[model samples]
Target: MAIALSQLIAETDQLLDAARFNDYCPNGLQVEGRPYVSKIVSGVTASQALVDAAIEAEADVLLVHHGYFWKGENPCVTGMKQRRLKALLDNDISLVAYHLPLDVHAELGNNVQLAKRLGWSIEGGLEADNPRSVGLVGAPAQVQTPQELAAQLALALGREPLLIAGSQPVRRLAWCTGAAQGYIDKALAAGVDAFITGEVSEPTVHFARENDITFIAAGHHATERYGVQALGEYLARHFAIAHEFIDCANPV
Candidate 1:
């Protein structure tokens, strides 16, 4: 039971509406491989370890949230990049990636999936002006104190979040996953009681303090591990393929 690689990629592109996004890297089918895909391994990033794991799983496709050839990364076919690409090519496994599209998809997205796991009810986009905003404003099932929220995140993500105990949830919060610390301002604009993101800068402390809002810095890898897995499961169920989520953990 398998599907054509081209068909799988095409369906994913449409499902995630990848063409609508202005992403740093290409959205779908970053590396071409065999014509058919029977097994897929999904993960947060397409690192060497993940590729090795995919090869061990006999995966025909490596689908991930992060892929190579970023907007300003060193464009050289040497060293680590060379090794990774060589391995994928040698194994004849396709690499499919979705960056911003995976984050913003209404269903099977990082934001939505994270919320589903944490029992957070999404209200709207972080940016009031843009409905397609990647960051999300939402509320947990129950209004919780900063400590309670931190505990919840820790339990759910398997990593303790860096909690700035200040404002307690008054039924609303905002969040964006994977190194979106810069979007703190956008979250503030959403007027949330707390802001949750993968990482935080020094200035984020001042902003959270000054504005009486809580801040939680959950691990980037932890926060973003769900979207690709969700996508992979969906693909597997639809196409009669095998899917496994490979977690090559990064503490960051």
Candidate 2:
């Protein structure tokens, strides 16, 4: 059954509560399409391929992590941004996105979902006092070697994770689902033996090596595809809407 665009927005806002996040981009509908939505497309980013998929499916609404109007991005909307938005506008497809909110949701969040898939029992947020922390701390069923854990991550993510091995076995682990190399310090403070994030910066290599923490650089796009897919499935079942996660492969 198709839901109205307004109702979809209301449901999405209620599910994610975008107001909670201090994100780079606006968290809700960035573009308006038809008043009613039957098919909803979910993806990691609203890239050209994803937009094309949405168009091919004739989806009414496109939900994603990376949407337009990023903080500090050129506001001109003249090139790639223009083309992306133009595709949505030209196809009359609505675009809705949730950034940190999607990453931080306790159950359906990216970090939480990854933890679950890896048999990690979450203890708390990596940020401690901050409730909106995107990174998470957790324990595996038992202590595993850094190599074992890295293998698990690699198998699950379908990519060989870049591992910076520490001397000790992994007991406590912290992870963030996307490009969160900056949270290395937070993980270190949390006393986790290993820190896993999607992408790694150059400095992160040195930090992990110097700090005696195992750092894993899993593919950013690979690590994030699950949360939104799970969310789409949940929303489809709960809200009785057609949902599909259109993955646009990104190596970085």
Candidate 3:
């Protein structure tokens, strides 16, 4: 069985609305493909390699977090952008993306998925004021040392997570999935012992050192890979479609 692109778009749109996020780009069906989709391929970013892989797999829809047409990004389809777009268009591969919405969704979000993997039960979002905040605040199923937590993350993500353990065990934790160092203050204010995100900035090192909270920089792509994968699986199960994840390694 296969779902039409229009039906998929409707499902995605409903999910985005329920998540309540201010998205960076359009959330669904960014590129059009065939009317019916049996195979859905998902990833963190819509890079050239991912596009090529999706085309090779004959994916009807390519889902991702970081799609084209970012606010400050060059609008012109040139160089890498042109190649990626051409690959999708030439193959008639529909591009479906959900950025902040995917990160903030309570059930299918990156933070929630990561928390579930690590045996954490989410208490609330890190930002109490902003209901749509991407980071989450939670307590682990059982208290574990910072080192133990880092080890768990490494095992789960298949990469060594950079840990800056402070003075205590981690019970209360805050987390955002990718390139979210700027939210350190929000996590700190939530009074979490540990804060985790992907891609630490230079200032993040200093902030973690001085803030008296443990910080972990897990790989951006690795941390984010789960949410979209979970979403793809959900789509597959519900619509009776086939789903696969195209993993593209990214250190940052």
Pairs in steric clash, model 1: none
- lDDT measured at residue 140 in model 1 versus the true structure, 0 to 100: 86
Per-prediction CA RMSD (Å): 1.0, 1.1, 1.4
Once all C-alphas are superposed, what RMSD does model 1 give against the true structure?
Answer: 1.0
Candidates 2 and 3, the one with greater TM-score: 2
Which lDDT tens digits does candidate 1 get at residues 1-252? 889999999999999999999889999999999999999999999999999999999999999999999999999899999999999999999999999999998999999999999999988889878988889998989989899999999999999899876745557899999888888778777778888989888988887888788889998999999999999999999998999999999997
Q: Could you tell me which 10 consecutive residues in candidate 1 have the lowest summed lDDT?
A: 163-172
Backbone clash count for every predicted candidate, in the order shown = 0, 0, 0
How high is the CA lDDT of each candidate model?
0.91, 0.88, 0.87
Q: Give TM-scores for every candidate, taking all chains together and pairing residue i with residue i.
A: 0.97, 0.96, 0.96
**How do the candidates rank by lDDT, highest first?**
1, 2, 3
lDDT pick, better of 1 and 3: 1
Instruction: Report the C-alpha displacement of residue 251, candidate 2, in angstroms.
Output: 1.0
Model 2: lDDT of residue 89: 94
lDDT of 3 at 121: 89
Alpha-carbon error at 101 in model 3, in Å?
0.8
Residue 242's lDDT within candidate 3 is 97
